[model samples]
Target chain A: MAWDLSSDRPIFIQIIERIQMDIVSGKYNAGEKLPSVRELAAEAAVNPNTMQKALSELERTGLVYTQRTSGRYITEDEAMIAGLREKLAREKVTEFLESMKRLNYQPDEIVPMITEREETQ
Target chain B: MTSLLECRNLTKRYENKTALSDINLDLTAGHIVGLLGPNGSGKTTLIKLINGLLYPTEGSVRVKGHEIGVESKRVVSYLPDHMFLNDNRKIKYILSYFSDFFEDFDSAKAYEMLGRLGIDSEAKLRTLSKGTKEKVHLILAMSRRAELYVLDEPIAGVDPAARDYILNTILTGYNEQATILISTHLITDIENILDEVIFLQHGQIRLHATVDEIRQREGKSVDTLFREVFRC
Candidate 1:
């Protein structure tokens, strides 16, 4: 996956978000081995130390685990993945609703608009 | 840990003009640092002093806790802004020259990078385009396992694609314990990869902070902050 990072934010935090998105999207399946820090750093075009810091953050969250003498692997917890997926969905929906309200759409009209857009899709 | 490069009350003057004045800074290991400023901001003068290409008029520069000299030169790999390679030499000859001059030079890694870039080893330096020459220089500089890599405008005067390639090479090539100090005015292109940034203005150090601190506290990118601070 292409690592699209903005310069306004901390790169390590962005790296963590990207990896989390990848895991939730099934780009990296649960229990699968993740790429080494160097490999990911090269792919992301970031400093290796930054990538290492991001991976350690993930390990702290229980989203990843490191095996001695081997490398890091994604968490095998299905519930955690589902929880993250829900959290992301809610955040995106909240953003959408906030924008809609700013455009003068009532909360009542927002649901129908979303339904209409969904049906058209 | 001791700093990899330290400048204490460093000053540089030529005749009546002062290029850098009473500057002091310390850079530790394992960081990709951006030395940022506008034209004639003393960036080059400071880098030249660190590389021992030019002597300071006052104070001193130290590498790995020692004064800048033969021992410091051995650990500091420098890539100047202009073309430092001989235009008459073949790429292979240049690689050989680097290997002979620097004990830390990795000829095999140089060949691998050359092959990856599709640059012919037998091609003369003058035969290649300007961008290709820059790439060759960068490859040579990064092939050294030095403790400090001082790159002067490595991404300047190149297309976006070439800039990306250069950044990637630097990211992958340096030793883990080494520090890279890159001098450039193009802040946004190199900002994401930099662990810390040092802002230079009028031969003085303005600010030195981690990338995260600037973004988190100021709520602006380095490029935006640079424009604000250096507005004409």
Candidate 2:
């Protein structure tokens, strides 16, 4: 799928977040070879330099690593991926809670509503 | 490390009206810079000055440390605002003409792109529709392995679907070391591909900053900012 990037934030940051989500969700498995920067950029409809920047940032975060000759790949560290998965889940929870609070829902009433929706489904 | 393009005190005046005034800018290698402005806002004038099509009134434009001359022209692949090719010639003839004219023009690449568009090489330019003609010209311009690509309104005339094709071609087929300078009013369509953007207004530069920097500092997209800044 094409990258649905928002314009208000930094595009590279969005790239990083998208890749992180993809990695944690197993779209890109651990130790899987990542596509070349040019390919990813073209798919995202972004500049190659910006894609390169996002990939380099991912390297820094230990989600992806470059092998010099063979090119970049997803990190093999399961612990890091698990940690990122938890972090993303928690961020989603925070967002959900904020939206509920804005709708005048009580903080203590959120968990029951979440459980009831899950049960109904 | 040297600037790919440098403009110093560049000003252009057409008799009674000043088009560009006292512009000092230097663009480094490898970045996609957008030259943006509304109608009659000196974007075209700046591009014309860079291409040596029109002489600047006050100052100069240098490419890779030399004045705009044969060497600079050799390195700057320019796509003017309008069609420059003779429509009577066959596409195959033009392909050979480009190969003969420019040392760096890639005949194979141009043909490959034309083939992708299903454009018949034996057909004359006059037979193609306006959109196809624009794409064909873009293919010709992009086929050159030049150091700096100066595209003036490359995406303006075409339809939305053609716009996507043009942007994809631009994003995919570019040399890493070569810088691209795109002048267009379609900000939202191109914001993601730009490293830096220069906003021109009333014959002057209103802003020149990285896309991320502008978004971070302004808390809005470049399109929104442009609308706000140039609002009537």
Best by lDDT: 2
> What digit string (tens of lDDT, one per residue) describes model 2 on residues B99-191?
999999999989988887778999999999988888888889999999999999887778887688778877888898899999988999999
Off by over 4 Å in 1: none
The most accurate candidate by DockQ is: 2
Fnat of each candidate: 0.72, 0.85
Global CA lDDT computed for model 1: 0.90
Q: Worst ten-residue run, lDDT, model 2 chain B?
A: B161-170
Model 1 error, position A104 (Å)? 1.2
- Give the range of the ten consecutive residues with the poorest summed lDDT in model 1 chain B: B165-174
TM-score of chain B of each: 0.97, 0.97
Model 1, span A17-39: residue lDDT tens? 99999999999999999999878
Root-mean-square deviation per candidate: 1.6, 1.2
